[model samples]
Structures are given as structure tokens and as C-alpha cells.
Target: MQEYSIAYAILAFIVLVLKNDIKDKFFFSLTFILITLAGLFSYEWKDNFTAWDIFSALGGSSTIALALLALLGYLDYIRQEEEVSIWLHVKDDKGNIIQKEDTNFSILRKNCTRQELQGILGVIADVPRYELASIKESEFMKDIDAIQIGKKKKIAIIVSQEKEAYQFNSIFNNKYKKIEKLKTQTSLRIDKDSLHDAKKILNEVGMNFSEEVNIFTKMIVTHKGLSFEVKIHNDEVNDLTDKLQNALKEVARQSKEENL
Candidate 1:
């Protein structure tokens, strides 16, 4: 009975980990084998134990194990919420900051669903199938709510237990139709043309975009304006905004030098 209790407790813990997207099936099966071997050595089979007796053995420890798992999951969620952050900024044509807002990742993740994200992404870029699980995980894509491009356009990236997704919009086309987003790159100078250069510059400044990993990024350039959104990870709101502002300034300076 004691061995059964220990085995059930370990099984319960393994199930909890599996629930959190971590796989450890081998450990799960191994625990059962060890428990059965212990039972054989203990001469428990000689006691004529019925199959129904296993439930009684599992009852107490299994209950405790599940309770412990729930508590641990709750604590982990609280820690993640404390760490998640996003800083939204609006910049003018010359890289001057016009406005800003600070928000948390949890708030944004719950605000939208995956289907809506795909619709919005379709409007923003030519890419098809913009789902979260399909996206590769990377440093740049961690704990971000959204990124605003220029004064008018924006992209929001969100991840949830159910799905991961991204969406895009602009001041002029806040409710933009699917067809309207089909506007050609000729209408926009930067469109998809400058994404590579922008990523290269951002990488030079320590904001590396992992090509193999899914890092949500968008770039738009036109005769009217240019904007791109990149995910940032930092708990300190003010510090994140300061770093972003400095990076933008550096990018502008570089552009000016190239022109000169």
C-alpha cells in the first residue's frame, strides 16, 4: 500500500507537467514498473489483493499530489504575469516620440482570439496562416503584447494556452477589409522591401531576430511614412521605453549618415 501511494503521487506530478506542455512519458511508465516490482517483492500478491484495492491505495497520496500541482501552477502563472510587459509608442516621421502607453502581456493575450489574429495579420502582411503554435519560439518573441509602427499603423502579438496569433492595423484602416490590405508594395516604399535591412540594423544593437525561431516582426515603408513592430522583454516599463527610444534614435542617425 505504501509503495502504491508513492507511485500514484509521482504519476500525479508527471501528469501536471504534461498539462503544461512538457512531455515525460518514460518517467511516468517507469514509476509504475518500479511500484509493481516493489509489490511483487513485498509478497502483496499472496494477500489476494483485488483490482479494486488499487483505487484505495491511490486515494490519499493522489489527492495530495493533484492539490500540490494546482498550487504550483497558480504560483507560476502569478510569476509570469509579474514579468510580462509591453510599451507602446507613437513616433513622428523624424523618429520623435509623440505618445506612449504601457500594458501587460496577460491583458492582451486574453483580449483576442486566434482567428481574429489571423484576419488582422492578413490585412497587415502577405503572409498566410499566422497562428501561434506554428510560430517558432525565440528570444525576441517572448512576453510581448503589441508593437506600434509609426503614428498610424500597429501590430499586436499575443500568446495564450489555446493558441498564438498576430494582428495588424492602421489609423486610416482601423476596420480595414481583407481586400483593402491587398494594396501593392508600389504604394508603400518600405512595404516588405526594407524588412531585411531593418532586422540587420536591429540585430547590430543586440535586438537579435531569430530567423529559425518565430520572432513576430513587421515592416512598412511608403511615401507617406514607415513603421515596424518588434517584441521586447523587460519587467521595467520605463527602462524598456528608454531603450526603445534610444534604439530608434540610433537607427535614424545611421540612416542619416548613410544618406550623407
Candidate 2:
């Protein structure tokens, strides 16, 4: 029994290390065969070996297999919890909570037209390595607009001007049809009063105007197969562009890492 336990432990280790290389069907078939063989070898062949003896041996083997599976599950759960603690709630030395959280920026000036906002965002979206896909009005909301960009790594630009403020958003994804493992979102809000000066700075930087009302920008990123949400806020159009580019780069990096 000791030898059998040692052998099972070794087998479990191999499974854990090469789980990606082993197919599910092959692993299950191998497990069934090994368990059956273990049961047969352990059974004592007395003068009249009966079906009950075989059943007892198989049941004992099954109990050990189930225990091993439970142990693996517990280990995986512990690993996940540790990762969440490390990655999900990161903070700076000042305890400022530097990790992913919704951020807000204040914009104080006169209101601008939606078209003008869209043009400014269009220039911001013009980052290196990413091509503009589409610039069109949103189908759902009249006041809201969108600009689609990128090919292999796609980003959906969401701009809204429903109330008196303006908003700029960028949603990053790997696929055109469906969003896969990695996604990152960034949103910027300009209050009603700030639009005039916001437009001026953005225009001096080369202004055009357009916007969303999401109070916080939600950026979702996957690290080591674990997904978490991050929020960021910035005051300038250049900062907004930098954030978008950074997000696109992050999504690209994660996709490459995961081979998605």
C-alpha cells in the first residue's frame, strides 16, 4: 500500500506538470487502466477468489484516486487565492492603492459640440501600430458615438455627450466577433464647465470636439490566466491617448502570452 501511494503521488505530479500536453481522453483512459490493474494486482487470489473480492479491491483503489483528485483541487484553490491577494490589491508605499481602480479627472470650461469631440478623439486614436477601422455614430444612443480601430488587436472607442459633459472611452479586445481572455477599458470624463478650456488645450495640442457619462473607467486585464478590473483617470487628451495606447499594448502582450 505504501509503494502504491508513492507511485500515485508521482503520477499526480506528472499530470500536474504536463497537463497542457496531455489530452483529456488519453488521461482518463490511462487512469482507468492503471486503476483496474492496481485493483487486480492487489486482490488476494485465494483457493476460491470471488466477485466480492474483486469489487473490494476496485473500491479501495477508487477511494485513493478520489482523495488524490481532492488534494489537487485544494492546491489549485490555494494558488488562485494567493495570486488574487498579490495582483488584485496592489498599493504604493504611501498606501495610495496604485492598482486597478476607477479614476476621475476634472474638466472646467464651456461645452463643445459632439462632432468637435469626435474629431479630437480621432486624432488621439491615431497612435502608432494601430489603424483606424471606422468612425461612425452609435446605433443605440444618438448623443453617443464610437470609433473602431486596430485589426488583430481591436479597440472600440466610445464617446458620449448626452448631458453637458464629454466622455472618451477605449475598450480593447483580441477578436472582432467575440472578446476572448484579455480586455482593457479606459474612460475620460469632461464636466460641462471644463469643455471650453479642455477643448482649447486639446486644440492647441490640435483640438476637434465630441463624449460618455461612465463615472469611472473600468479596465479589465488578465494576468497569468487571472482576470481583474482596473480604473484610471487623466485630465489631458494626450494623457488619454497615452492610456489608450498603453491599454492596447497590454492587451497585445496578454494575448501573445496566452497564445490566444
Candidate 3:
């Protein structure tokens, strides 16, 4: 049993080092506890083991215990910023807006009308007029819109049928050379009838779209005024700007690391 505990402790340390997810932390904690208890109850208690055996268990278990503490801190960091949102704006120095609200978001459901598009895009149309696409249902033209961000920088907004969001995303990728994609939560399922009601409400001012709409909005970013595609789990639209900035920085950091 003492040998088994030592082996388990060593294995757990290797796994914690290799895996980066939060779940791995839980795994390490469980294995650490089991090994600690096993060592306490096994032959080590009879004082039969050498100093080397005692040191091995203590060192390995202590490593895992410290890792467990770090993992808990990381989990709390994740919990602090849990909300679904759109990236309304991400700016760079020189006043060049890299990712702005108008250019960074698109929503697609089973059925979306022009009026609904107007309502969704209209919210941010005050200062500069939002360039709305004339509703088209042609075989080639999918429901999509464009919001200009800065000089030669634009974001595409697209709407698609259920499960077809990826297909639409592919279309965007093919058109843009370097694009980064960020995926947000799919809104609550919106039935066909509810979609119609949403169009009606969007046509009005005070009313808001119902939460039941099965909508998925992705932000496709341009790399260095070219394009780069990245996918991030969605959060609150209000808070997405910060997340987007973090993603952009991460990509840049990775590129730097790779070059080194």
C-alpha cells in the first residue's frame, strides 16, 4: 500500500503538469487525498519504512497540495467574469478601432426577417448610420449585414438556420484571408412563432426581443487589418469587449512565443 501511494502520488503530479483544464485540478485533489490517506494507514504507520520512503510521500503529496490551492484560485477567477455578451468595441492605439460593436457581431435563428435585422442593428445606429443590408432571400445571399469599424476594417453579421452557423462561418472565412471567430452562447431556443413575434416587436421601439430566440452570434476579427479566425465561448454582450481584448492579446502573445 505504501508503494502504491507513492506511485499514485507521482502519477498525479505528472497529470497536473500536463493538463491545463480546471477539471484536472479536481482529479489531482482527489488522487492526492487518496494517496495521503493510504500512506497514513499503510505500513508507514508501523515505522518500518526508511527515511527515503517517508520523504518521497511527503514531497509528492506536498506538491499536489500546493497545486490544489492554485487551481482553486484559477476557478474563482473564471467565476468572476461569467456573463454572455457581444463585443461592441475593441480599440487600438492611434484611435484605430480594431473591433467595434457594429463590426463584431451577428445573430442567426431559424427564420429572421429584415425588420428583425433592423431592430438588432438599430440599437447602435445613433452616431453613425448602420449600413443595413436590404433583406435578400436569394439562393446565394444568406441573411447577413456589415458594420464598418475603421479605415479598411469591417465586421460581418450573419443569420443562419439551425446547425448551419458553422457553414455560414466557413463562407466568411473563405472570403476573408485572416479571420478570428469568437463564439457566444446560443440564446434560449426561439420557436418559429416566437420569431415572428420578435420581428413585430423589433419593428417597435420600447419592446425587446424575447429571450427564447435560438440565436448564435460570432465575432470574426481581422488580423493586422487582414483577418484571423478565433473561437471563444460567448459571455454577456456588455462584457464581451474585455474578453475580446484578452483574446487578441493572447493571439499576439502566442505568435511572439512561436517566433521565439
Candidate 4:
């Protein structure tokens, strides 16, 4: 039993290492299944009257463990393949679906801070005006907004300003007769100062605005495909901007690790 336990542990470790190192799913699956079956059949079964001996007669404990691990690994591999398929299924400018291997689109990690999101948004927004597909506030959530940078990338930003939430909702819902009505209702206004500060943040991250930045009070933006959601808390804009640079650096590191 101790020998069998040691064998099972060694097999499991080998499988784990192979799963991480091997990128070709078909090859890995074939190799793993062959190895697992070989291990199972290599064991000799001897029948004894005792109950413990009966288990060994069917298949040694190590054989059963190896079989279970193979099954689990196969299931997990299928799940991973499905996820990759969904993310990689993207369309070209002509509305034709591009092959997964052909497309350069890489999915961003779902979990991102507001600052990190804003930084990404700022970088995308700094592109040529013709490159921007659309930018609009979310209809359902007041604090949530989306910007489509080019055809491939769409990002949603959700801020934690409760005061601005109601205003955005009113504007989006058509409750206000005129967008100018918002001027008197909210203390927070998009002024030159705010615009300048926003630009400064973008410049710090090596992104320069190619076109005039338009701050919209009321506009509808709808994105059908997958989008990365960014939730923002009530933090000072400058502080958020400063942290954004570091956050972006960390995100780059993580993305590189994942690709490896």
C-alpha cells in the first residue's frame, strides 16, 4: 500500500507538470490517457478472501486514483478549451468571424480596479478619432459607462460616485427636459480644469490625445460582445491616476505570466 501511494503521488505530480508545460491540448490528453491506462494495467491483481484483498483484486488503490485523476484532468481540459473558444471567437471589420489562431485579440483579466480601467480607457481613448467606435453611458446603471476603442476592444467603467449616479440615471432615462438642467442639480461639472487634469493623467501613462476629448452628459452606448467591467470607488482623481500607472505595470506582468 505504501509503495502504491508513492507511485500515485509521483504520477499526480508528473501529470500536473505536464498540464502546465504542454500547450497542445490534443497531444497532452493523448499522452496523459495513455500513461494513466498503462499505469492501471501494469498493476497485478490477486484475489484473496479478505475485503481489503478484494479491492486489490479489482484494481490496486493506485490504479483507481490514477484513473480518477485522468478523468478530472480531461474534464478540466474540456472546460478550458470551451472558455478559450468563447473568448477567441472575434469578428473582423467586415463582420466575418476570424479564426481563433488568426486573431490577435487577447482577453483582459476580468478583475480590474477603476483606476486601472480608467488608465486603459485613457490609453485607448488617446487613439485617432477615427479609431474610436463609440463612447456612451450605460442605460441600466448610472455610474457605469462604456467606450468602444476600435472594432475589437470594448471596456465598461463603473464609478462609485453616488451623487453622479442619480444625475446620470435622470439623463439616460430622459427624465430631464434639458441636459443643461443637470448644471444646477449637481455640483460636479465637467470643466476645463477636470479636462486638463484628465489629460495630464493620460500623458503620465504615455498616451496623448489625438482628438478633442468630448465629455458627454447624455448618450447611449450599447456593446453586444464580451466586455471587461471596471468598478471604481470614490478616490481622488489624481491619486487614482498615480496608482493607475503602477496598476497597469502589474497587469502587464500578470498577462505575461498567464501567456507563459
Candidate 5:
């Protein structure tokens, strides 16, 4: 309290530099000061001048550092937040993705008009000779309007031209409760019919499922952003799973022979 010159300057500089968090972090600090005059007036504790003098000596540098520290902290506080992750890893030799692959997420069952699902999948190939063809065709209700609802869904599935999507369509079309797909792969959505059936089956055939399965078989619908998934299994529900599997095996066998 002997001199307020240096104290005032340091305070001013900090106020300017840390104009942002000043109001919040002020009384937020711990500080104790002994006035030389007050101590001298009191006969009890007049010997603490040494500590005050030491702090006063380093006062300018400390205040500058504190202000700089606050500014840096503020920078980090408001720094652009990173995106929530939506990624999956496949470790097979041919499946290691070196970089993000170009993906086209289709809303096959969700926003899909029968016309759209019909467009590419070729009129839901009947479950006849397809090995795992769905026998529960009567169960799949046609909720053609499920996609346009105000609240959107989060779903995940590996997309390839090969089979799974087609298999489900072939097996469960017009039978299972519904098929809902995300509008953009960016917009995660799940197949409700499959999800329901899978959940029921999960409880019934507990030990039959993969112990290592990571995605949801039954998802609790919530929207804190990240949840994308699909159910994977072969059952009576799969219409063309048998045929598709056999055909795929044949293709693999032929390619191996050609290489020889």
C-alpha cells in the first residue's frame, strides 16, 4: 500500500489484455495483501514488509504473464470444436481403408419411395430360391411414409454393391415392419423392421450372436448426434442370402482360377 504506481500500471495492462475473461476470473483468484501502514499502526505484526516487497518487485512481470496466460486460455476455449466421429474400421487384408472412401448412403427403406427401392434393386427379388429368404414376409408392414417425419434417425451400415442391402430388401420387403434409410450417409438412419426383429431374436437366441459384435442390434433412439448402425445376421428373414452367398463364392472361385 506504500505506492500504487506499479500496481496501477500492471492492473491496467491486464485489464486491456484480458478484456475477455476479466469479469469472470477476477474475484476468482486468491490474494492477500498486508498494508505497511496498517501493520505499522498495529504493534502485533509489523515484520511482514519483506514478503510484500518481494511480491512487489516481481509484480510487473507476473501480471504480464497472467494476462498473456489468460488470453492464450481464451483462445483455446473458443477454438473450433472438432466434429463428433462417425467411423468404422474393418481389418481384413483387402479392407484396410488407406483414406476415407467415397461413400453414397442411401435411404433405401426410410425415405425410399417404392419406386426408388424398385429402381435399383429390381422389384424385390422374391425370397424363393434365395438361401436365407425371409419366411416372415407377412410381418414387414409397408411404412412408405416413415422417412419424412420431422425427427430424423441415426443409422450405420457398410455399403457395397455386393449383397446385404439387397438381401434384406429381397427377404423382408412388404413383409417386415419397415425399411428406413438415411437421406445422406451423413444423416445416420436404421432399418426399424430389422432392428425390432433382431432385438427380439437377440433376447431369444442370446448365445447365437457374435460375441464381438460392436454395433447396435437394438438401438435406444436418442439424438445427442452420434449413433449410426445396422443389424447383421443370417436367418430365415434373409430371402436371397443363400443364393447371394453361393454366387459370391462362385465369383471368388472363378477369380482365383483365372489368376492361376
Candidate 6:
């Protein structure tokens, strides 16, 4: 029964990962293999009284361990890490102090997702997706919001997309959609249409909601203002926006949601 509990938990995880995006056929199949193997061992089988003793029977913690490893692998494949900075900055139009920029950005860093990148930039730049917690402990990244949690509890991180690299800096200052979110270099073919859907998905997924910096793009085939919306947690939001957009593209076009 204990094995069954763990196995079911793993299966649930597979379902959750798959729910993010089924477009990655490779990921889909990998998930299937993991769930199948986990179920096979956890479920009763004739002459397969393997139980939790899989480690001993397999001459080591190979089979069940492999199953767990497989689960981890799937998680690594689907789980997206977003880069955010817990920064200290100027306040609102009313001209009031925003906060310490230290404590304000600090708590948010600790609670929400955090990651490591090749480097940090005030604006757009290529950062290989490398998320890690230990990097948070570094003295160098002291001001960066390594974690974030709670209400009105917010974070401020620059999205590395060249188009909207100035998001954090321009949140209040930059005119909405004025800057061109360059299309060619954003590291992905992001569009305005899909980003809206991603916000709905994040809200549905229960992420703490916050504002986003706009990414400017080159004039599209329609010359439709050349820009896109990138919510907070630049990578995760953009990734979700892409997936949601792609999925919706496959979903037949729909009306635009103004506040993506």
C-alpha cells in the first residue's frame, strides 16, 4: 500500500506535467514510460513479489530508483524556471518611496521560483536557462529576489529578452506598447496574441499575479504595433505564453484578451 501511495503520487505528477503542454511528443512518451514502469512495480504481479525490495532484488536500488529517477527526469523536462530580480528602485507617480527595494524584493525572491543564468542584465540578453537555488545564497546576488511569497508581495526582475529588457526599469515610466519589442532577437517567436492566454493559465495554475514589462517586436506581417507582453518571472511567463499561444493556435483563433 505504501508503494501504491508513492506510485499514485508519481502518476499524479505525470498528469500534471502533461497538462502543461502535450505538444512535446517526446515528453509525452517519456511520461508514459515512467508511469507504466512505476505502476508495473508498484502493482502486484505473479512471481514479481518485488515490493519495495526492488533495490535488493534488482541487486541494488536500480528499478524503483530508476522509476523515481524517471519521474525526476520528466519533472526536469517540463518544469520551467523563471528569472526574477528583487531590486530596489524608485516608486510611483505619487512620488512615494516604494519600499526598501531590499526587504520588498527580498521576501518575494525567497518564496517564488528563482534560478541561475549565465549572467544578469538590466535589459535584453541571452541567458542560457539554468535555474538553481544555491545561486541565491551567493553574496553577489544579494539584492536579487532569490525567492518570493505572499500577497501584494511582488518581485522585480528584468526579462532577458532583448526586446523588453527594460521592463523593470520602464514599468511606470515607459509608455505602454511604445517601445518596439524587436521580433528577430527575443530568443523565441513570441506574439501578443498568445501571451494573454498564458496569463490566464498562470492565474488558473494559481501563481501570485503581478504586472509585466512589454516586449517590443519588429513590425509583423500586419505591422500590428510590433510588440508582445511578458509577465513577471520572465522565462516562466514567456514559456507559458508560448505554450498557451501554440496550443491556442492549434485551438482555432479566438478574440483577444486585452490584459494579457
Q: Each model's TM-score?
A: 0.25, 0.29, 0.21, 0.23, 0.21, 0.24
Please identify which of the two predictions, 2 or 5, would achieve the higher TM-score against the true structure: 2
What's the lDDT of the predicted structure labeled candidate 5? 0.34
- lDDT at position 155, candidate 5: 19
Model 2 global lDDT (CA atoms, 0 to 1): 0.41
Off by over 4 Å in 4: 1-7, 26-31, 34-38, 45-123, 129-260
| CA lDDT for candidate 1 | 0.40
Candidate 2 lDDT tens digits, 1-260: 75366547555665666543555466555655565566557556688878897788777777666665566557544433331100012223354433332112111111223444344444433233222212353431232211110011112232221210012122112111111333243344445545554555544543244422223445555443466766654333456575444544554555457675
Between candidates 1 and 5, the one scoring higher on TM-score is 1
List the global CA lDDT of all models.
0.40, 0.41, 0.42, 0.39, 0.34, 0.42
lDDT digits (tens) for residues 1-260 of candidate 4: 54455555655665566644454465445554555454445545455356665555345544555565667667654543331101112234454543222122222322222344344444333222212122233341222211111112333333222112222232123221211211111122233534555456556665444533222233222233333333333233445445555644554555557679
* lDDT, candidate 6, 68-176, per-residue tens: 5576556544333323445433433354444333322232223344333323322222223323222345433443322221112335432222233234334433322
Ranking by TM-score: 2, 1, 6, 4, 3, 5
Q: lDDT score, residue 249, model 4? A: 54
Worst 10 residues of 3 by lDDT: 143-152
Number of colliding residue pairs in model 3: 23
Question: How many residue pairs clash in each candidate at the backbone level?
Answer: 4, 21, 23, 0, 20, 21
Candidate 4 — which pairs collide? none
Candidate 2 Cα RMSD (Å): 25.4
